[model samples]
Target: MLPRYFYNFSTFMSMFPHNYLIYGADVSIVGATALIIFVLTYFKKWKWLWDNWITTVDHKRIGIMYILAAFAMFFRGGTDGLLMRTQLALPNLHFLSAQHYDEIFTTHGTIMILFMAMPMLIGLINVAVPLQIGARDVAFPYLNAISFWTFFFGAMLFNISFVFGGSPDAGWTSYAPLSELQFDPGPGENYYLLGLQLAGIGTIATGVNFLVTILKMRAPGMTLMKMPQFTWATLITSIIIIFAFPVLTVALALLTIDRLAGAHFFTIAAGGMPMMWVNLFWIWGHPEVYIVILPAFGILSDVISTFSGKKIFGYTAMVVSLAAIAALSFTVWVHHFFTMGAGAAVNSFFGVSTMLIAIPTGVKIFNWLFTMYRGRIRFTTPMLWALAFIPTFVVGGMTGVMLAVAPADYQYHNSYFLVSHFHYVLIGGTVFGAFAGIYYWWPKMFGHKLNERLGRWHVGTFVLFFNMTFFPMYIVGLMGMTRRMYTYPSGLGWTALNLIETIGAFGQGASMMIMAVNIVRSIKFGERDVTGDIWDGRTLEWSTTSPAAEYNFSVLPQVTSVDEWWEEKKRGVVRPDHATFKPIHMPNNSGWPFLIGLSFFIAGFGLVFNWWLSAIVGALGIITFLFLRSFDYNTDHYIPVDEVKRVEAAAGR
Candidate 1:
């Protein structure tokens, strides 16, 4: 009874599977969506949302939106993980088909890295960096909005494949030959290429935006050496993003051409080399690791020093180590495919380059340790996460070093051991650090603190369940169990370890639920942070009011030393008089950024299904918006001095 167009779409049936599990998912999604719609409608917040959130380009608001999206994606990715673990919990389990498993794993990796980790860190950067550096806002407010919306829409396009077409099953890496049109020949892979392409464009813009912001916008008298550690981390990470993301762009473009235009850029039959894809991928991939992590490193430095009641030890060395790590990240990409027969000479060079990174990393670890030694350490939730990171990351780092050995990697390559090591590094290093930053800065972002007891519970359970989940992967991995297997026979001695990992996975899920509850409960009843300096903080951000004014600083701060706010506190330095207040010029919000993102999403969806007409419409819309933005001269306004004074007075400054 279906139309001819419906039958023409080969993968449409896969989207609506006959399985009961997918039916449950469908019902849950519908119910949740309806509930959200009902609440928004009943509250009459549509216009409020449109005017204040969707059209606004305030860095802090944009940052909050990014974090919200990241958290949502984390749930989706985490659920995918739990489902995969459930399937593997017992031998011969048919909870998921092999094909479904492939799709789930692919989405899991892609979502966690691109949608969850990257956005969470970048969100924190946006929320805190401008305030720390005493800048009113990023250099290009509109461009910043563009970055966020494009990333949002791109993620939307990628996620919808699960229900609209079919999910990408080529792994997050999307290795060529397997990812080629001749092999995949579906809308799913096209979604992967175009979705990442859209998001990657936004990422590159963010790097440029922040790079210019930090280099040009710091407070007066704040030299490069005098900047806060998180700001420095943002700076270095921006450099890595600028240099590294272009390679990814090119690789994705080449693959897109191969898939859509009959090009053979990554195809073997037409003289295309598949390994070139791997080389290009890792060229971006290895540095991509640092992109998410360097910011966390910056966060830990600030948090560690703040809670320890001491200045960070070896500040110069820490900066040197950060830069060293960023520079070395590019040289070690070949270690990812060391077993690919790139010859011993090539492998040796990359392996050594990989291990060389450990020196700077170890220096950072020791610096954190030394900073904590003999200090009045406060065991706040954020500080606790920081402390837990040291030992967990150490295990991850040692395992990484072991994997870096070219000859030794042959045994561990593609095993559960490798899975364990990857999770330990990413979850231990990046996730732990993100949690710390969130807890440390929650008050600054929201004008209230998350409940301390609930936060402690969240951190405790997360760290415990996290270890229980991945540590055993090492043991079973060495016992010859491989990664990405949906089911295994019982006699292989892997069932017990798999079951243990499954239980831990669910516990981790519960921990995330605890965090969700903590956030929701704290929003209404949490302790208010009226003083802004709730942590007795060190940076310029603490000098501003909680949830900072629209213009971050009423007057640009004059910084004279590292931890300028702390120094000001020591001297009992009063803020400048309101008599000094001046009109502040701020960028007017525009809807073009949102429209542009929508256009990209439309084009991406069209391209996924090879619908050229829709793609052309989206491309034209993008051009139209850009043209409009160019002619719009009314893009800024000034807040009078009285408004600034009123805002300051309301904060009781």
Candidate 2:
């Protein structure tokens, strides 16, 4: 009984079977949405939300929004993980159907990597980078807003696929031949393509934005070498993004043409080369591994040094190794597919290049150890995460080396061993580092310290359960449990290990719940950070107020050395006088970015269903907004000195 304009709405609805789980989820989603809308309306806060949040161009506020969205995605992704574990808890379990399993895994990987991890790290970069470098804001404030909204909308498009159409079941990579219309024949894969394309555009813009910000906007006398380690990490990560994301964009665009326009770019029935998709994906994908982890590296460095009460040991070597890793990251993409008969010479070359990454990585590990050797160590929660990263990442790195051997990889490729190594590195390294950074910087972001006792419990359970969950996967992987299998027969000897892993998975989920409780509880009951420098921090971010002002600094700092703020503290230096304050020019907020993101979402959704009319309308909306923005000359204003003085006086600065 659907209308013609429904456009396969019946097909979409039929994809979901009539089941209590689906019904319960539907009810939950509806109730949550209604509750949120009612609360916002009842509080009469829609105007406040629109003015200060939706249309604001402040980097700090935008950063907070990104983190909030990331946390939400994390919950979704984590639930997907738990469901997968529940299905696999015992051999021959039917908790999830094969189709359902594939969709869950696909969404889990995409959401965690693209939506959760990237945004969380980028959010931190946005909130902290300009302050660390003493800039009023990023190089392009308006573009920065566009980056966040595009990412936000893109994530939304990907997430809604499960409920609207079917979710992408071709795996997170969406490899060719399988992902082609001849096989998938649904809107799910299209969601992946367009969603990633939109987010990828935003990611590339973010790279360009931060690159220019770091290079052009540092305080006086802050040379590249004098910058904080985290700033250096941001610079390098941005460069990787600039070079890496375009390949993904091109690959997604080609695949979209194959699906929507019936092209033969990656189709098997024509003059298409399917391997090209794999190559292009890994070319970007390998660098992407570095893209997420490198910032974590930076966060750990800053945290280790701060809690250790010392300058980061071997600073020059750390910078050199980071650059070395970035260069080598581009050269090792071939290692991911050495089993594809690329010849021994090709495999050997890539294998060697891959192992070489371990060298620089080892150098950095040693630097962390040396930094902590003789210093007064603070075993705070952030410090604990940083300290835990050392041993955990070493385990990940060693296993990675094992997988790098091309001859040995034939046995390990696509096996649980590979799965083990991947999670070990990602969770142990990147996820751990993110927690460290969040805890370290929470006060600066929120004007309050998370309860230390609760923080300890959070980190303790997380690290313990994290190890429990992922370590047993190595054993099951060795027992020949290939990933992506929805079910396995009994008597495979995987029952015990799988059961252990499921228990551990739930344990990790419990830890996440604890952390969530800590965050919510700390918001109201947490101790206020009266001092801007809560951790006796070493960076310029701590030089400003706990939750920095609209314009971060009253008088922009003048840098002289590495860890300039710390050095100033040692020398008994004082901040500049209020008499020296000047009128601060800042970018005006714009709604164009928000509107453009909406336009992209609309166009993307239309293209997902091959509805050209909707697509064209959305495209025109985008063009119209861009044209309007190009002619808008009144885009900036200035904060008067008197207003600045009044703000500072309130803060007791």
Candidate 3:
């Protein structure tokens, strides 16, 4: 028997309007124009953006670029959120078609999770790791640039769907049956698959790079135990990405093969089990949440300790709980689909495991609290995000626990409650933490601190509006409003909350605009900051000049304790006074990383078009770039001893 609401691929295609062809043509023209502009700009004397930005492999530069890219994607994703909120504000509103709504949530989730949050975390890791450990650069500087550009190219491919054809309408998870070729034959889904796969390769590359960097690139005397909290988080996050993301790669590949090559990993009539896709996807999906949030945990820890002017509390417990969370996060993905008839035994096991994760998380919360106890807390913007996170995360965690009850999950599954729960955790934890890191490190990254008064506006309005928007989702969810539905009957009593949520969504938009204004003002006209110790920081990061140099530390510090800079300062160790300088070896810029990224973009487009020749060209581009890189052999050149001596002499060291 046919399942309910079945339709063939051709019939499904006929449902959409014919306006897409024009849209695709317009997009192609725009992309071609942009490429021409890029070429013209680089060929002119405005080559600095390409030379200093595109080809430079400095971790700080790369981190800033990652963050700027994420913010751009954030606004793009926010537009999706606003549209979803507007459409759902009133019952039976046809302002947006069901197809459009599907695309909204799909791209919203994709852009936010994969492009915005993940890249922001990568940015944080890139900027902080070398500074915290007193290293000159990441172990693989070229790989760092390659990884970031690769991800950027993938994001470009995903966004290109808007012009060339249409955005993907499958949900972000792109579940099987719904995502199979027969159901979603458009090139949009193909774009999603290829774009994410290309980006996934970059994610894996970054994971390996960070893992090796942390393991091998510490300062002269720093040990594992002495490593900062954020470094530990980066280590664990890298491990999770390395192990968990491959599952997604395999699942995505199988889906692509099923769509393009007629293989039947998920086709219902061909003895393929869609359940395998769900199982495999969630195996990667659940841990992916932790992969993004783990760094936030580290960010909160660092912020708390710095603002509180104390050592981190119960460091051993914090470390152990982090490990526990990483290990346990992988065991609980099945809870996402308890309503799918996974059997009582399986659901019960996953439910219990899911709830167990809360324990380690709770332990972490207490560690932060104790770290802030009775200490002089400055309550900076970063600290504000940290404070807000505690209660907000608890609420989200409570909802998560409520949903973890397998028997009760049947009510909450596929409901807005799940949506609200994740948004709370995601926005409250990861997004807030990312912003906090920005405020905390902006001075160090760029030679100026962000405007504090404007920052207050950004933080205050964002928190207020964010809560107002999402809190009502819980109420509507409890009243039995299901998720992903474009319209509903008026008698459901869901209009008021939805309207309130829409208004809050507008508030979020305004807050983002304010943030943009602050960023712009700070860059062009805001007060200049010359202080090395912006925020009177406690870490070795502050020991270097603000807007740290290409080689982070001229002479690697001999660390003897935690908060090494603080201890040295307390002992009256003045900069340029008892400090000796050494010659620096730094990597030169190369266009190879950019070439690799461009090739991946080409390969992604070829996969989308099923053009073998284009694919071959892309492959050759990549191989040639790699082969040429191997033979260049001029990766590192030394800062001469005389140069080092001159700098030291000038500083009076």
Candidate 2: pairs in clash: none
Pick by lDDT: 2 or 3, better one = 2
TM-scores, one per candidate: 0.98, 0.98, 0.94
Tens-digit lDDT track of model 2 for 48-112: 99899999999999989988999999999999999999999998889988988998999999999
User: The CA-based lDDT of model 1 is what?
Assistant: 0.93
lDDT (Cα atoms) of all candidates against the true structure: 0.93, 0.92, 0.87
**Cα RMSD (angstroms) for every candidate in the order listed:** 1.7, 1.5, 4.5
Model 1 CA lDDT for position 582 = 91
On lDDT, the leading prediction is 1
* Deviating ranges (above 4 Å) for candidate 1: 1-16
